[model samples]
Target: MEARTGREKQVYKKGSIRQVAGCVPVNKTTKKILLITRRKKKGGWMLPKGGWENDESEQEAAIRETYEEAGARGKVTSLIGVWDHNVINKKTGLPKATFSFFEMEVEKLEEKWPEMDERDRQWFAYEDALKVLIKPFMREVVEKCSLAPSNKRSKKEFSESNINKNLKDTWNLKFSAIVVFFAFLIWYLIKDNKFISILT
Candidate 1:
């Protein structure tokens, strides 16, 4: 697939904040996040993100960015949130771009990609992935994923385990109360023989 290049037909040339779409690609089983090398200066790892054309939605743009940059794609999930930051674009002056980052549970990583000649991709452990990133907003995306339980399968399992523990505790407490009530009844019968005799 050919990568979309240049400032071709992007949204918000007139608007104040330019809207960019991004993806946080993760492998749930390996618990790793995918990061790609910067094609130009700065020469550090970052998430896959870029501007979409006028026609497609932000989600579609995000998925496209992921595949184009990282050569990875999968189930494109929830939007983590929108992040706003300034960019020193020569053409646009000092306008900020708000990136709508989404989480993608990556299923496929290609051997060759459209921009493979310019960029390289690798997978990193969740926390380590956050450390390698230079952009604050990109890090924010990973951090948001870390805190969001629904995004991770392990988090969902933890939640289920917690619920089971709570139920077990409740059952134990009820059992103890029943045992205590029976003990009190037996003790009262022994202490007051006249009460037991009247019952008989």
Candidate 2:
């Protein structure tokens, strides 16, 4: 499944195996989180997500799914967390399967609707979205968003450590240079005097 503009296209074959998906919510300037309603589905007010295709990786699948469901385009900023849960088909009473969830940042929002399969789409505040989502794990994703940093700190910390190491190296080099200069001066002075040189 994929979405462009506000329309969603679903190309997957029916009764396929379980697949991965992304639950993406965008925070607009007004602090509203966009939610997409699945057409004809009971629990529609949810994040955009879909299954992993044959050639696409999990992250790629997430990107495709988010657009397909929400009609919002964005980049996968960070992986907040993953969850494994059973989805029972309401009509068949059979276990649907497991799904992998990812949190993403919507890069673009268009007022024009895309030609897609989703029923409706709208934006709401984080608190309002929490009330509408049907699954408990979906809510957990929102909570995790609050804790996860906007920019990942691990990479920044690693770079800082490298800089510190480099500075320490430079300091050691300067200290060694000073010691060598003093030693050379002492040796030269001892040799300058003929008496001291002969005594050595």
Candidate 3:
């Protein structure tokens, strides 16, 4: 689907606050979040956000933005709260946009998305995400995102996360074992024959 680029259907709040919706797309474990690069790689990286359209609720708009900008589909719970910030001539000019950021548990990731050419997407550990976020409002969204696992993910996804984590741990253990074995072999080759007698 084509992303909505024009503000014709945008939802404005009060008189000047432009309503914007975005999401902190994350794995079921909430260990990492998905971020999208700025169109020109100017803002570094940011949560998938855009104008809240007139036809959709804040939540719907947020999820839509996640799919369009981050190429993620997932489940989001209630509001993670909202913040209001002013835009300063990077893209949307000087209008103030009121934002509602959701904590989304990503379920499906598409290889091709509407904004694929416009942006690049990646998953980052929560702490790393904070470092690349250029906007203060976006940082606030990360800070407010719940890190506690909800344990609400579908069994299949939850198992997948566990399996992935286990595999990583197993690899680390094997790597460490190899390093230790090589170190011992080197030490044996250099040590005096007296030290070898203890092991024999």
**lDDT leader:** 1
Q: Which window of ten consecutive residues has the lowest lDDT sum in model 3?
A: 147-156
* Top TM-score model: 1
Which digits, one per residue and each the tens of the lDDT, describe model 3 over residues 1-91? 6887898998986566789899988885648989999985555998999899888998999999999988899999657778868554455
Residue-wise C-alpha lDDT for candidate 2, range 74-156, written one tens digit per residue: 77766767665566677756555446666666778655444244357778777788899877878777666632343337657
RMSD score of candidate 2 (Å):
6.8
**How do all the candidates rank in terms of TM-score, highest first?**
1, 3, 2
- Give candidate 2 misplaced runs (Cα > 4 Å): 1-17, 41-44, 87-96, 111-117, 147-200
TM-score per candidate: 0.70, 0.56, 0.67
Once fitted onto the true fold, the runs of candidate 1 whose alpha carbons sit more than 4 angstroms away are 40-42, 87-95, 146-200
lDDT value, candidate 3, whole model: 0.83
- Taking all chains together, the TM-score of candidate 3 against the true structure is 0.67
Candidate with the larger TM-score of 1 and 3? 1
Q: In model 1, where is the ten-residue run with the lowest total lDDT?
A: 144-153
